[model samples]
Target: MAPVPVAEGIFTWPSDEPQLIGSRCTSCQIVTFPVQASCPRCASTKMEAHLLARRGRLWAWTTQEFPPPSPPYAGPTGDAFVPFGVGYVELGGEVRVETRLTVADPEALTEGMEMELVLVPFRADEDGDEVMTFAFRPAD
Candidate 1:
């Protein structure tokens, strides 16, 4: 089965080292993830597509003890549910992104530890294709 992106225009495809796509305001030099058309800080329309830092440091994290709400979370259901880690990764002080953590063990996680962007299987489509999404993991 072919692997597909969870969302398009978020990261580059067929890459060895994936970098997030973001929007940078030309006026204020502010960067935003998901590539905003207008600057959130200064409301400037002079935004340009920018590639985000692939490596960073873990800032903070926590484990989701319960499964998230349905209708929005298209993940495992009922007994198939598994808790996951979520945290903020500060990318070279350019931005702090709240992303899923690949580390399931809490003990393995430490604040200020080096991290790198990684793509992981989020779910499978009805066609049996795997849907991949971005996550942060301990740097290699």
Candidate 2:
């Protein structure tokens, strides 16, 4: 089975180095993740696909101690579930992306710490294919 992205167009796939896909407002220049059709600042429909910075600073974070509700959360559950880190990482002063963090220990994570984008295994599908998702880890 082949590894697959959690969803389409969230990040660049089939590449050695992947970057998150965002939308920049052609009018106001505001950037948003998951690509938006309209600008949140100016409400303009003119938006373009923007490749976000691969590195950033951790702005804020917390741990998801429990499994998120199933409809939107497709990862492991019950005994298979594990706590993971979640945070917003500010990329190139363009935007702050809310993402999963590779480090789960809050003590190990600090605000303004340097971070880099990475792809991590999210879960296995019914077909046993690996589902990959984007995350951030402390930059060396």
Candidate 3:
């Protein structure tokens, strides 16, 4: 898998599952990933980056195993990504984030089930380097 370039001081992947660690404005209490200079809700510049939870509940999902047409992916060309579940997950005390589901069987996936984040190889680069990507796995 190719190496995915991550901007410095932008986001941190504490666990295998990457969470969009960001700061929330104390004035308006708006959550922004990457610790914005100013709050979008209250336009306050005071904010701090905080680590989020690693588990959430699946709100919805859809499989799209087809290889992405976007860049940074150089695996088997035209190879489908294999139908994997992708949907919104509500993190406890955090926010509802959209992510892909990491389940072997799509039919077994159900809404409202507990899910955990997992880091997996996204794709291989030209040098055969594995690009690590995070996905939400069903815990139930």
Top candidate, metric lDDT: 2
Question: Comparing 1 and 3 by TM-score, which wins?
Answer: 1
Give candidate 1 misplaced runs (Cα > 4 Å): none
Question: Compared with the true structure, what per-residue lDDT tens digits does model 3 show for residues 44-68?
Answer: 8888776656787888777766766
Model 3 Cα RMSD, 1 decimal: 3.5
Q: What is each predicted model's overall lDDT from 0 to 1?
A: 0.89, 0.96, 0.67
Error of 3 at 19 (Å): 4.9
TM-score of candidate 1 against the unseen true structure: 0.95
Greater TM-score among 2 and 3 belongs to 2
Write down the lDDT that model 3 would get: 0.67
TM match of model 2 to true structure? 0.98
Q: Candidate 2 lDDT, tens digit per residue, 19-102?
A: 999999999899999898999899999999999999999999999999999978889999999999999999999899999999
Q: What's the true lDDT of residue 129 in model 2?
A: 98
Q: What is the alpha-carbon lDDT of model 2 when measured against the actual structure?
A: 0.96
Which model is ahead, 1 or 3, in terms of lDDT?
A: 1
